[model samples]
Target: MSASPAPKSYAPWLLMLPALVMVVVFFGIPMAYMLRMSFNLHVDEKFYVPGFTFEHYAQLFANPLFTAAIWTTIKLAFAAALATVVIGYCFALIAWLKPPRWRFLLVGLALCPLLISEVAIIFGWWMFFPKNGLLSYALVSSGLITSKFSLMYTEFAAFVGLIYITLPYCFFIMLSVFDGIDKRTLEASADLGAGPFQTFVEVLLPLSRAGLAVAFSQAFIWAIGTYATPSALGPDTLWTVGYLIQDQMLNKHNWPMASAFSMILVAGVAVVMAVTRSFMAKRQAVHV
Candidate 1:
């Protein structure tokens, strides 16, 4: 009998067809249309009309409000990502070092932020930061302050909210990295007369560097794309890229401008991801 024919290689692409179609329909088409409209007309503020001009793009950069918003967004994202990495690293280390029975519980707590809805989290902070909220109540009850004090509508609140929202994701990512590492490496370092700080700096940190980078990037990306928590918890001046997009589309009824803003945000995120992946790749190559 003749040998059986080899199996076809079309299976993977066939499986991916639906996702490919969804991506094209949802992402590609919308982006193309938005790009086209970015060069279109404002049409007396009533509607947009097709035109070929760079005036909109020019005006976007010319506007100081937009420029300041972009700066605020960058700062908030950087701060949040740094904070998340530090806090998540500690939390994940705790989870990793704990007994098996408590490990799951600790991880569950760290991941709770991701599981909760963004709106719910915002509401929780909204209640907690106000003059009549938990902080004020506690301080007043303990006589720490004669009058209620609130951190609401401040940059600090925004930072707290951003960190809280992104911490779980970073924690989970770092936790997985910590899990992959052998604890005996740390023990070995200690056995050789390395102190706790020295072992961490030499062994644990080196091994975990890639993970830390990944977590920071993840948190930063999320923080950059988020608008709700910042707007709700932060002061009126706390404008960000996502908030700008929302403003242009909804409040200003400027879809093309909103689309333009979105494209810029996407470009920013792509650059960050590219840079981070490049760093990770270089590190892996060096290690290998």
Candidate 2:
């Protein structure tokens, strides 16, 4: 007798169809609509009709305000990501170097911010940067400053807030990466007379490259999407892409312009993500 034929595998594809449909419907459709809208005109405080014009794109490209906003957004995001990664590395190293009894506690403390909401984090920083808040009060009490000096509505405050908001996520990523590293290697490096700095530069950093990339990308992406924290913490001139989109959508009543800004922001994020992924893949390949 002939052996029974093997069954075909169509069930997994069938199961995935709903998710595919949902993505196409929700994500793809909106993206395409926005892309189309970006080329259309938003005339005279009315509905966005389908007139194909490059006016919006031209205006966006020509406007110095948009250009400045893009630059500011990039600067803020990059700065915040870098700060978070640096602080997070130190935090993770502390957690890794500690005894097992203290390891979990250190990691848990690093991750507490991530457990809280963005609004809460913003509010906490808001309270801390003002004259009546903890930072200014501490400075006054400690005799560091003669009087209560507020940091609120400053670029420094915004940067601090952004770093604080993103540091927990960066710490957790680095901590997980650090956990995978063999402590024996550091000991061996020390046995070979390598200094702590030298060992970190030669061994720990190279191994943690992937984690740094991930943490940077995560923080940068989050910073790009954040508007409220910067708006609340910094000066009025601190206009990001997020703020631009929000203003266009709500304050200006220009949905098409808002869609255009949204598309640009998405494209900017995509480019950054692609570059980061490429760099990460190259590092991984080299390491492997």
Candidate 3:
């Protein structure tokens, strides 16, 4: 016909060029630099030699503080992810079951914490948790306790802040999954004399397992990498890997060690993501 329009192959590649450039410039270069730097040796207070060595990585495991930080990071992330999943599931289920008109309000309320910046949220909680803040004032004023008591600088406060920050992600993820589920299934289960708990355990939970895995993984990764909220709210002893990374890079001026810690964090997150993907794939296969 008219030379068959000469094919459109180059157009797609041209369209993708910008994205490729951005990725290389933003991600690939930095990642390569970090990996290279991780192999370097720290010479002194302000200098790191460019020679390749595994000393940084070796020190990461050999140092008791670093190992403890790894354990603490895992423990906090796991606990926060678990709590977020359970609470978010309940909240999403309630919102999903409500009338369409009420759903908007429920989602809005759930989004309130997310709408605020993390720093602002932390500050708000900081004020509310201190001895002179509203919580203590109210308890003392209402005769609930003899004197004002502070909840600040406690593991509980850190956990609360972590859960608050991550809950919205878990909620939206489960909410989307819940939207795809048919309410008629619940009705059918009820018709078959299944109670609410039975329907949830048997039908709802199984159906949303993939979303749960994804949400939990995301929350865990976030918690693991977060340093500010935990550091501000938790006691000094509650050191996390993220805090340690910052400490190594900024306070100690140890670039190689910082890079090594960052690489380890990245590896841990990657492993979590890989496991989640595998679990989700298996779940999908079973359903199929």
Q: In every candidate, how many clashes are there?
A: 0, 0, 0
- Per-residue lDDT tens digits for candidate 3, residues 89-118, read 999999999998899999999999978888
lDDT of 2 by residue, 1-288 (tens): 996655557677779999999999999999998898877778787647678887777778799999899889889989999999999899899988999879988877877887888889888897898989998888888998988878899999889988988888898899889989999999999999999999999989998988899899899988878888898899998998888988988888787888888888888889888988899889978978
User: How much is the lDDT of residue 204 in candidate 1?
Assistant: 94
Evaluated against the true structure, the overall lDDT of model 1 is: 0.89
| lDDT of all predictions | 0.89, 0.87, 0.91
Clashing pairs for model 1 are none
Ranking by TM-score: 1, 3, 2
Error of 1 at 109 (Å): 1.0
Least well predicted 10-residue stretch by lDDT in candidate 3: 1-10
Q: TM-score of every model?
A: 0.92, 0.90, 0.92
Number of the candidate with higher TM-score, 2 or 3: 3
lDDT measured at residue 12 in model 1 versus the true structure, 0 to 100:
81
What is candidate 1's CA lDDT for residue 203? 95
Candidates by lDDT, descending order: 3, 1, 2
